[model samples]
Target: MKYRIVEQTRPGGMLAQVYREVLVPAFPPEELESEESLAETLETGLGSLLVAVDDTGRPAAAAFGHWWEASRVQMLANLAVKPGTRGHGLGGRLLRDAVDAWRERYDPCLIVAEIESPDARMVHEDYGDPRRRLGFYESAGARVLDLPYFQPGIGGASRRVQGMLLLVIHADPTFTPERLDRLSGKLLRAFITEYLAAAEGEPANDWDAKALFRAFDREGGIPMGRWGTRP
Candidate 1:
């Protein structure tokens, strides 16, 4: 499969179908960003758009990642495979390719993903099983962090993003616990406030720790991978 950069920079192609037919149906209302927000995000220069194409030139899978310059990392924001293309390992291939691309461009120390927590508590439509999702990332060398991270609300929406698991794959062998803690905060702020839900007159995610702590309650700094949660 050929990987192409599908952003607002280059339009009038398969991106429309990928977003509408593939992503819109794949993600729930809260998780899926509106089309306008997506285009605006791509215009910000801090994020990217990537699509994996088939032999016939159809867009098979697509993903997006937002850049955190301070930590030099990329947050794998959204990844979705076309309905008919699921279970062929396309999701895994797309993720691996995106990680390689990020490393080639930025040499980031880590790649971050926030997934549904592995416990059977929270659920969603279509892709509701948390372990199934986390297991996929684990197979790709990603570990489910024990951090109790919370995703801030999306844009003006009031729905809270709950039951999150922070999954990270690191490139830096020299990373100390202190460094990882610092990295986590930076990424959360960038992705939560600046990119995903920056509303008018509101403080960035950095300034909202009190609110965040109350909202998400992710204070413990456990760094261990929850391998025991795997099926």
Candidate 2:
């Protein structure tokens, strides 16, 4: 099947509808912004969003990333495929395009993605086991940098038993110590606010690059980089 990447906008865009009707249905409303709000956020230029259309010109998958200036990193915020279109590698194709688009503008751009940890309570209760989701990214060279953390919702109300896996992919071959530091810092911050702080119980409120680096360094299940590295 043919594929083409389009910006988040277009008349009756499939990306917009899918986000509203499909992805949101599986998660708490407070946990994510509504499709209309997301569309507005994307239009503000704080990030980039894209949708993939199959040969029939129907939207099949979508992904988006927000720029973190403090760490000079790009945080991949959302990725989803149309329900029946999954398992066809459309998600990976969309991700490839997102990475390539970022590389054109930023050298050695560090990419970060967050997935639900396998044992998370939310996953078990709401989404069922997360092995398939985790496995998909792991096969894509994503490494889990930290234990699952809580994801905060509206008005300081938090979702309990929710944890996230932080995965990093460094694109710049000339990545320097300084660049790594910045990228790592951003990842840590993201982990704290996005995952750690939102957790229930007495989870640690602080983390640093060294801590995250050590976490991933000790684990070796997934291939570290590139598509062919796995399998």
Which candidate leads the pack in lDDT?
1
Which ranges in model 1 have alpha carbons more than 4 Å from their true place? 1-12, 120-125, 177-201, 204-222, 227-231
lDDT of candidate 2 over 128-228, digit per residue (tens):
24677777776776655433334443334334324556567553433323433222333355444444332233444344323443443332322233223
Those runs of model 2 whose alpha carbons end farther than 4 Å from true positions after fitting are 9-15, 26-31, 121-129, 152-161, 171-187, 190-231
TM-score attained by model 2: 0.66
Worst 10 residues of 1 by lDDT: 213-222
TM-scores of the candidates are 0.75, 0.66
Computed on alpha carbons, the lDDT of every model, listed in order, comes to 0.63, 0.56
Residue 160, candidate 1: how far off, in angstroms? 2.3
Give the Cα-based TM-score of candidate 1 against the true structure.
0.75
- Shift in Å, residue 134, candidate 1: 0.8
